[model samples]
Target: MKKKIKLTVWMITISLLIAAVLFVLQQHSFSMTEQKIEIDTPQGQLTGTLVLPESYSGTVGLVVFVHGDGPVNDTYDDGYKPLWEKLASAGYASLSLNKPGIGGSSGNWLEQSMEDRAQETIYAINWAKALPMIDAQAIGLWGASQAGWVIPKIVKKVPDLAFSILVSPAIQWISQGQYNTRQEMILEGFSEKEIKKREDYNAQILLLLKEQASYESYLRIAQSDDLISKEKWGFFSKNYQSDASEDLKNFTTPVHLVLGGQDINVDVEETERIYREKIPKNLLSVFYLPDADHSMLSKKNASSPLRTYLTAVFFPRHIVVEQYLDDLVHFVSQF
Candidate 1:
């Protein structure tokens, strides 16, 4: 009877611990107090916010958030607030910028190359390093998606970079777009034959870029009824030849790469394969969450493209799962 009672007590204790963990996860999301900050860059005056955590003391490390595609606002006003808050509550400072031509910042993000973005971000890194409240030695970066290309460029040249947190980043711009096209078609329930037709056309574009072929070559790939508009061709022309494989090889900083196994926008398997092939596993901590989609939310309910495009104007509709949130916190805490 004594042994039976002891087992019951242990089980109760375990249940209580699980409940406490769940409670902390649920309550972790909170609003943060941030300072309006801006910096002058050669391209324009870059504007952003340096969000601070409450009830913290001592010089804290700062996380500079590098946004993915499109014009990202200073706060990532759409979806990133919760992440900033969680990081802040865990004793790290966060900063996010208004991309060029967005908010008070000038210049065009679309017009800038990976090189231009890296230079601008390097400027921000220097600015953060010099700040008195920031732990200059612990300045790091957090980026995702298109930033997969941009962050590698930054790390390749800047050896002093402290660390990095990457989520659902792409490997090659060209292949990534192909993956998006194919997977989007699959999600829309297209036939395997239709998928191959699209993928084959994209492959031709890769060959054209490699052969330094003319505009006519790419034009041939654009079908008359295709959803891709002619106006967007400029984007393909500028970035189709770019890849981050070399940049990944040069990365010396400790990196934590997170992926959504169910991500429809990117080829997660290829991404993991390349990272392991290019960098030593010792410098990396990789996570593949099967149930999470590209947004690190549920695959069953991913955010709409329209909603993502309007992030500068409103709040994010989706919240990252507790599992992802926990993994991020644990990774950042290591540094």
Candidate 2:
């Protein structure tokens, strides 16, 4: 009788432990129906991930997430996992594609220009619209960093996109680079004169790029002793730039602009200037969060290197994830 009682107690304890583990796993794993689709673009065949909410019944609006310049990894499992999960919970199906040459996708990412990337997005948009579960008329674009450039290009091509959300978008690549260099100097405790010298050098480099100077010539100039700043300026000159604000003139889609006040990569002031002077008043929604750096995290101070480093590590700060998603839900609900 004693042996039987001990055995029963052990069995019950094991079952309880197993049940607890299963419950935790279930909570972590949100039910998201997924599909793998291939989008053929002018450049190459692009692979994309389409995630539908578990409780989704009828057709629902889809949100296509476009990654920045960096290689697109498993956003579903990594960086934007929370946002994707949040959107799924909110009844919005979200799709994110591995940029060409990244993840399981094909093609050479380096060889592709901005236009090529934009074409890829357009192809993905078409593919998403074809999904029976997706409401074709209620599609939206969410772009961050380099995708900012790509988003406007696609919108221009499609013209009738529902809306777009640009997070820390680079308005002008050249200006953004210049601003970043200056911000770095300020953080490093450079004097006013030193900062001015760096700005002048950056401006000259931009002028050279505008003139279609040879890559080698640009390199030589950038490395010249006259360029007082020690900062390297290679890729900045190579990147494509457009009059984003001017291109936005043709955009009828509503735009939600979220900027980190302490963002050092892109000039907050310049973004404000463009928003005020260029973007049409009726279509723009602006939100500037104080103490928030490029990643939207609350920092000890704007100039703290540690904060900057952390922001770089986690782009699109996680602290404001809830608010961002809430705003998005509200925005889409309004339309």
Candidate 3:
């Protein structure tokens, strides 16, 4: 009886081991090949990854990724790989560059203006166009959040680009900031009085930015523990007046504008309205994901820290709304 019990336990352990191995394989295995690539630009060397379909022959379409905000690496900590895999399955390759000061890249992203970022993206596009494996005619732009300001600048300069994908992009810097503050405060259950107070404070900060106040001058007024870093203040001061309306009018290529209903970061309604007003109907397509949030994560998953953590660990690829991925692949397939 003892020997029989021991044998049963051993069999169970082996089965569990096999299940774990399969899980790892399923998580890591993708229908794409990735290689580290470096590009030299006037600013510095950009460290990134070039992801391509595993079975593709000859040149394929390329999607150059522009990071939204913050210090993000090439794959956004692998958050981009799932989308990369999907694009690859649709016979498109993707190139993502690490933001300056992140992932060993030289220079500071905070020191750049929207036009500076646009110039960097143009350099990346030119570099990609020279690659033998990339179809220059099919190259497009995929930008999100803060990239909204950068993409329009690129569209104005790179007239031959195939397409542009704008995800949760904001239209104006100041108005977007106001909307974000109000919406997030309400979502967090802030009372009317508290929300008003925060808005008032934000107004003061905007004034300081407009006045070109030094960091020391800002400290005298802010008086809050959550102080802005000198770098952040510089970045905000440089870009506070950015508006995309003027640049949107210059778009000569097809654009796919993605908006999330649950996004509090950008006023999606305003974004949709202005894009419609500025861009011609024939060249514009809108995808509204009602159940997705700012980052395209499902509303439920984004609401809970515990659930988000678990889902990211066990099903990293499905962290974003599944439909969002489907729509992305579908859009790319059309080209």
Instruction: Report, for every candidate in turn, its global Cα lDDT versus the true structure.
Output: 0.79, 0.72, 0.92
TM-score of each: 0.81, 0.77, 0.95
Q: Per-residue lDDT for 1-335 in model 1, tens only?
A: 99999999999999999987676555544566788888987777988888888866779888999988876897665477778877887788988888988888888777777778888888888888888889987878999888888898888777777898889999988778888998899889999999998788777766876776666666776666664434345555677767878789877889889999889888999888898888888888898898888878765445565544443233332356668877887888887
Best by lDDT: 3
Off by over 4 Å in 3: 1-18
Assess the local accuracy of residue 256 in candidate 2 as a C-alpha lDDT between 0 and 100: 85
For 34-147, candidate 2 gives per-residue lDDT tens digits of 767677766667777788887878898888887776666546345565566677777788888887677768875665667777787788888888888888888999887777
Model 1 spans with C-alpha error above 4 angstroms: 1-29, 200-221, 224-231, 303-318
Q: Candidate 2 at 111: error in angstroms? A: 2.6
Give the alpha carbon lDDT tens digit for every residue of 1-335 in model 3.
Answer: 99999999999999999998798678867779999988888778988899999987888999999999898999998889999999998999999998888887778999999999999889889989999999999999999999999999998889999999999999999999999999999989999999999999989999899889999999998857779999999999999999999899989989999999999999999999999999999999999999999999999998998998877766888899999989988888877
The whole-model C-alpha lDDT of candidate 2 against the native structure comes to 0.72
